[model samples]
Target chain A: MFKLIESDAPQRRRICEIFVDGEPCQAMIGEPLAAALLKANCVPMRYTPVSGAPRAPLCMMGVCFECLVEVDGTPNVQACATPVREGMHVRLIHGARSIGQLGGAAQ
Target chain B: MSTFDVVVIGAGPSGITAALTAANRGLRTALIDEQLSPGGQIYRNVDAVDNGMQTILGPEYLHGRTLTTRLQHSTVTRIQGASVWQISDDLEIAYLQAGVSKTLSARHLILATGAMERPSPMPGWTLPGVMNAGAAQIMMKTAAAVPSGDVVLVGDGPLLLLVGKQLLDAGASIKGLIQTSPIAQAGKAMRHLPKALLAPGYLIKGLRLLTHLRAGRVPFFRTDEAVNILGSDRVRGVSFIHKGQRIELTVDTVLLHHGVIPNVQITRMLRLEHRWDVDQQTWKPCCDGHGRSSNPSITICGDGAGIAGALAAEASGAIAGLDACFALGNLSEGERQKLVRRPARAHRRQLRIRPFLDTLYRAPEWLSAPLDETVVCRCEEVTAGQIREMARLGCKGPNQTKFFSRSGMGPCQGRMCGLTVSSILAAENGVSIEETGYYRIRPPLKPIPLLALSQARVARSAGTERNSQPNEDPTHE
Candidate 1:
């Protein structure tokens, strides 16, 4: 009987220290960065802080800038698009003043 | 409602040839495309250092420079970044450019809109670090940006191999090339190999990539399947089942491709007769020996008819050009045929290689489809299980699946999951993929915000008010 065994390769796991409260947190290397942040149970990487549009990585093609976290003081860096590098500091940009009130895009 | 002797839609191989040929024959011609510059998706150019405009169009398409330069000086108007929203049976086109929508009419229309990248679905396809091979090429060739430093190339057919080499040249390290088909299947596909190798340089180019893979010690994994793309926010790695063993490789980017499909949304909207090509996985506008389409007012040539690559597209474009000239009373039938003879031969050769290429990459059915748990539309987090349930509940087609399961209804629309969902529907219903048809693409085709659309209208009106000479034809000398 040819039986398939469960391989040791981990399919989904997270790396820690992505960003929290608009500040850079140390992230773990060689793990899923998003999962680690979620495991740590941080409420949000970025928020509207006023209208409170809770945004996360969506459509992932860099097309939708949802999971944008300020990296190395650069605001609006796509967290899902940008790979974590060693010693890379990440910060979350939040606040109603920080995220200006932009209305629905004119269709 | 400005009328022209001929209108060539899409400035790709087919469109360029049609425009150049018709313009040279002294016909008032217009060439339209979506990019900011000439050369369609294939021969894209980035920055203009001098008037030269360092072009990155493929080797086969490099010869387009002569034709493009001639077109630059000709009476033909090259309109760039123009989105053709709708084409009517009466040869009316509604297009938008620089933020304004305008309607144009033509006596004769040639739809050389060319082919698009086939829809490929995976767990994290909609995620930020993933892109189609065409998009990757555009980013590298047009935008002068590499998606990632380390990339894993997947899928089969010529572009996967070719683009991997190109990415390497563009300063990206291809971790490996994972071919879905086994080596044995490749042997079967080899019978139709002569068609691809018919040209003087085609075989050499393919062989060059293989040689480079060997010489540079690049790793290639055949008979493998990428089970899941592991990442939460961005692409972190890919897990595959290679010959019954699971192996996961961590990488920053994943370049997904399954060859090319006909860019026929505009054709479909116009209600032109089209036939589904099984092997190439695309819809081609039905045309006769002289490239006359069902509309009679419209003609189609090149890969938009089918995936035969650039050379065939060039030949088909020429055929369409000659046919347009004949219809415009500029050339006799005999003269047209004589002019198109060489190109017809080239197109025939393109058709020949397709069977071999199809067999070689015949996507192991499983690659496009995964288990119930595997996510198809990563944007909406729609899983295969959810789609199957929706289909069971009478979601008959991709449109319905989109409506119910939100499979093809995302920010990317159905460009990424349309084919896969269609394939799944066909498989569930026990039908052919061709019968399923691709997704419906509407205006503002590249997903511009509604704000951008309104702004575009304002810009167009202002530009007209300024009354400056239209500089839309950047390809012009």
Candidate 2:
């Protein structure tokens, strides 16, 4: 319900289905994955790790990492930066993410 | 490593212009950007945005279309969707593209990486529906999306008014516009009117936008006090004092802005010398008029150089491009001067209104040094009080504060919280922002997969082995 404006501009029809938090959602091919999710009313994209606070896409540009979400098994991927693809799986990041053993203990 | 005569990082107004100028001057240029297409934030999705949206964005946005087209047609090697993670002092640029880490070298590197909205650290700013006004503009420009329900715009600056007007035209229901610019600043801003009139187009556009906002019947409040966003999980309402009266608006979305500062992550990471701009109250790289930074090979242009707006960025970019060409012996001194004369005049003219604007919309101190409870660093969840306490306890500077509180050590690499932390430290410690200093930037500038880095290293070594002379150590040099 947060989609205020409806564009009459020609848009590529929704040609792909992606999973958001294990739920299948229709998305337009080649659009930002965040836009697709926002259109689907996925407002709270992720929860901050420290405060457990809900956060959504702030700057769709890559500068503000508030849009950080897990995409296709990769944690902390920016939803706004990633283009939607067929069968893309996006999961809401709940808390602090470990960069696995390879990221080193300091990070 | 693939090397080019010039490597332009960014595809915005300045980067595109720089690349075009360099390539046209017979330099082997490579233009790199993180977006899938050209046209940085100001003209995002320029090629794809429809005519209706174009009208809403105005002529400034339309200008990018021509630039994008020209860059696309140019001989410059265009690299889109590249997240540049590192730039060594030796002009080695490393980036991640399609899950692959690659490195390239350039003789002359032009950084046109533009500005970002100043960090707004008011209470409840970290709420879900709370975001930068520029973010809302990006939503409209890139995704053809707008926030539904009651939206309250908070803060001040030219961008706030622009976004508010655009939102109104796009039919978004703005509950109220809370202008944080103090009423007294208007009188101060008037001092530069004669100089500002030199660029009449911008003045006219600004007046027109104001007229539209006034006609749209949106409630406007001018105040200097802090506006508190109310919500736990998401923005529910905004409460503030306006004209000696308290008012609260029920709103689901809150857009905040307080002007923009250069996105200096890459520049800082390169360890270039930077100076604090007292007027802008931000650290910008020390560069000559032609945009050449402390590093002779690296040139900083556009908003990345400083917030001189898009027109100045374009002009400065051309000047920088020509300077690089001259440095490379591509142009004679006389020819370079001739080429720079026009852009220099235009750049100066475009910059005429900035002093007045910067003075008029100077962010109130409270916005930067929010209340104790307000979160200062979103990544680390460091509160303003916590940062202040550390500063008082002899934290010294941003780098020291980082060790004490881990504020700037998050994924954002101090982008979101650097300014706030530094200013708060400066304020608390009774020192200038320069003395308080900034985060010691490190690389990889952005997060990159370890596997990709290893693969890139392997590829680099393989290429070196294949090309090295019998007695030469390719890795050493």
Candidate 3:
């Protein structure tokens, strides 16, 4: 579990609401989506296809693929690399994502 | 496709200094980084942080703001949130930004991708509540976040103590610090004390971090045996030997780290010659004192080149920047030599203490070579036993293990498991880690979506059309 601590100096950024697993969650505008999710206690960002083991962000620097979450219907987005956008739809990925999931278009 | 005179690939201390130096010399430089802001991992989000947070992060972190602020006023282009997926030997770069693919051709390239925490795999490390201590620090820096429940820090290195102190100062209810440093190596490390005394600031700072934790009266433990981050879905507790007797402590989060290694995936993808450093116990791309790699056009600096700390990275970057200016004909060779003297001296002073620190914090063997059932490859859920079995079955190295068990073939492309797998294979075969070569890293360093991959062609064609017919109506799109 994680909590967002108030800095001694007041924050000067905007806050926005994003959807996490179909639930409304408040997130800082332009901060990492993974940080927002972790603040909301939304761990286990992905399930492994091989053994179905639950995983969350290991290396927040994007070296580990453990935090691959489906963002706005696009599967396999690195949560740490992705910034929080207003009304962004983020769903935890389950196993190997099918190419046809959500509204994906072929290359 | 060419857009800039020089393109720097990261915005860490090194990249920031490099870009600033190049731009100051009249080179149209652009710095591409994956972070939301400049100040790669070491000083990440340094500009956004306020004065109150500054004191908590320490003077070293505040050092980044000077560079970031300087870059903000410079003519250099700072492209944020860019995932550089491909870089060619000829200096063609492709990166995905906001789901759009863009390409840049550069006369010179500086890769300062920086370092990543050496994954010291322990049992149940794949659990949800487990993470790199560096990750927690990033969250704290970028989001003002901190662990709310009971936290346990596992592993060795000064970073572990620094993180423990930072988290404790941030009000984390740290359970205990489980040290995995090979204390047996302290004698060897002591032999380097005279040389380390040349750089007194770092040694004192490391002790200060430890002293801070000790003053806080936080519980500290050292483990010689294997540690188990006991949990099913998330971290529930930790199981390890406290003092010849196995003990279990209930905990909510487990942060593991064993120092950091050069993030050489970019260099490896470029097919640069790399050597396994016996001291650092990791793969480092071969580069000169001035940060020139095998490819003449590409320059490497900062921790990405090796495991030199942030201070050394900046000095190395300054020296590299001077060399680049000389190469681009912006500075005379004599002038470049004259300018490089100060930063070169600073780089040497910063690196003088590395041997003492490296030997003191060498990660124990048990941290990497976990029990047979312990999961080593987080992506594929491959166990340590599977890797050893593959080695016994005559898998030459980490590459062959990929075909035999798919340990290193997942989305991460072996960043998390590559080093650990090498250690496992080396132990199983009784060969040196240098002989057990690393996985062959390929392009698309960061995985790109198929849509973005296709966008590369579209972006390139549009650029070609615009350049080929300059007189035609510019609004044809």
Best-matching candidate per DockQ:
3
Native-referenced TM-scores of chain A, all candidate models: 0.53, 0.79, 0.85
For model 2, the chain A TM-score is: 0.79
Q: Candidate 3: which pairs clash?
A: none
Would you list the rank order by lDDT, best first? Answer: 3, 2, 1
lDDT of 1 at B2: 76
DockQ of each: 0.05, 0.55, 0.70
Candidate topping lDDT: 3
In the range B241-351, model 1's lDDT, one tens digit per residue, is 776777787887677777777766666556567786666555677888867888777788877777778777888888898899998889997898788889888778766
Off by over 4 Å in 1: A1-107, B46-61, B194-197, B377-381, B434-477
The C-alpha RMSD in Å for every predicted model, in order, reads 11.4, 4.1, 4.6
Give the lDDT of residue B332 in candidate 2: 95
What TM-score would candidate 3 get against the native? 0.94
- Which digits, one per residue and each the tens of the lDDT, describe model 2 over residues B243-274? 78889999989999999999989888887899
Pick out the ten consecutive residues of candidate 3 chain B with the lowest summed lDDT.
B457-466
lDDT for each residue of candidate 3 in B16-45, tens digit (9 for 90 to 100): 999999999999999999987999999988
Model 2 misplaced regions, further than 4 Å:
A9-15, A97-107, B458-477
